[model samples]
Target: MSVRLRTALLPLLFLAPTLSPAEAQSGTRPQDVIITYYNALGHKNYAAAYALWDRQGQNSGKSYAAFKNGFAQTYATYVAITGPVRIEGAAGSLYATVPVKVTAQLKNGQQQSFCGNYVVRKNNTGGSAASQVWRIDRATLR
Candidate 1:
């Protein structure tokens, strides 16, 4: 499976519960936007990756440099995910619950598999140029 598809799917899975006010307007189809953003990240498209972030910076923030570093590090830390993703959506956004297995190849190579969730939004929200960027609103490991 493509990395983008993998990345996008994870958020959709955890997007259950209810919609938030942040996402007022949504794209006709959000899955496409999610997948595209991840695809861009895999290709080393920093700008494209940034586009995937809301850029509002709840905890992440508006600085491109900070966002880039955070984005790259997270991707680098988790090699990949395994299994089908569960998804949820509200208003104009979606979340994915991704099953992940991570083993620090350097420290001990101990393999572990667990589900992690990510929330994302489609641009169109008016804020700083970066706020319109798509991004992982929050990620939780279950």
Candidate 2:
């Protein structure tokens, strides 16, 4: 798999529960955005996951078909978002970086861990309400 895809899918193995209204309005909560993305992936909803990323993040400039195929090869059966997602920069900043770790339980019972940071930027699309959204602009794994 491509490194970028691996990086993206590593964190995509997990799912998070519903968010509270406060979190929805925080705009600075990149974790909630990551949780929502992985939650879509957990349900095999590739389209939804793809939609969560910024234009550049989608397929890393490759076709969506390639992106979907990448996740198909992951073999992840379960995942959990572990630790706190650290936010860098002040609130209302144009961009924020979030540190994340995900533990993926493979179908073969082997567990693997991936650590990464998701760089998300505040979406400036449309009017005020839409501009409040944040999208993953990049995913880097280590």
Candidate 3:
């Protein structure tokens, strides 16, 4: 029937990535990068999580100062993560370099891509500078 065909084909239609490869690699999806950083922040691993931000991101409005302050607010919200975050096509070439994919979701409560996609990084020295493990998103999830 027409209804059945449209329903079946709707999923394939939304599978397409809205942004280009470069944009898609911005890094802020899934549970790997951002979530890990969230956990580190929650655990008071400031040194470790702070190192995960990209150079550009650190320079943006999301600087170290902003991170500390914003984290305080984020912690105030949502009690805990509900379930396992699903990230499609997650890749890490090395300890510092990782590529993230674009997120997808349906209008209805049918499907949703794990919040974001980001590549996490570590520090080089005594908080000397934030290394590049993964890029960052302008939006931070709780």
Q: What does candidate 3's lDDT look like per residue over 27-139, in tens digits?
A: 44433454454445545456555554556546335666666665452321111234444333334222332233323222332332433323333332333323322444334
lDDT of 3: 0.40
Using TM-score as the measure, what is the rank order of every candidate, best first? 2, 1, 3
Reference-based lDDT, each prediction? 0.45, 0.62, 0.40
- Candidate 1 global lDDT: 0.45
TM-score (C-alpha) between model 1 and the true structure: 0.40
Predicted structure with the largest TM-score when compared to the true one: 2
Candidate 2 lDDT, tens digit per residue, 1-142? 4556556655544345654333533545666777766666667777767766776345355567877787764455333455566555454546666677766545444567778777777743445765567777787866
CA RMSD, predictions in order: 10.2, 7.6, 14.1
What are the per-model numbers of colliding residue pairs?
22, 0, 10
Task: Please tell me which predicted candidate would have the highest lDDT against the true structure.
Answer: 2
Using all chains and alpha carbons, the TM-scores for the candidates as numbered come to: 0.40, 0.65, 0.34
Worst 10 residues of 3 by lDDT: 73-82
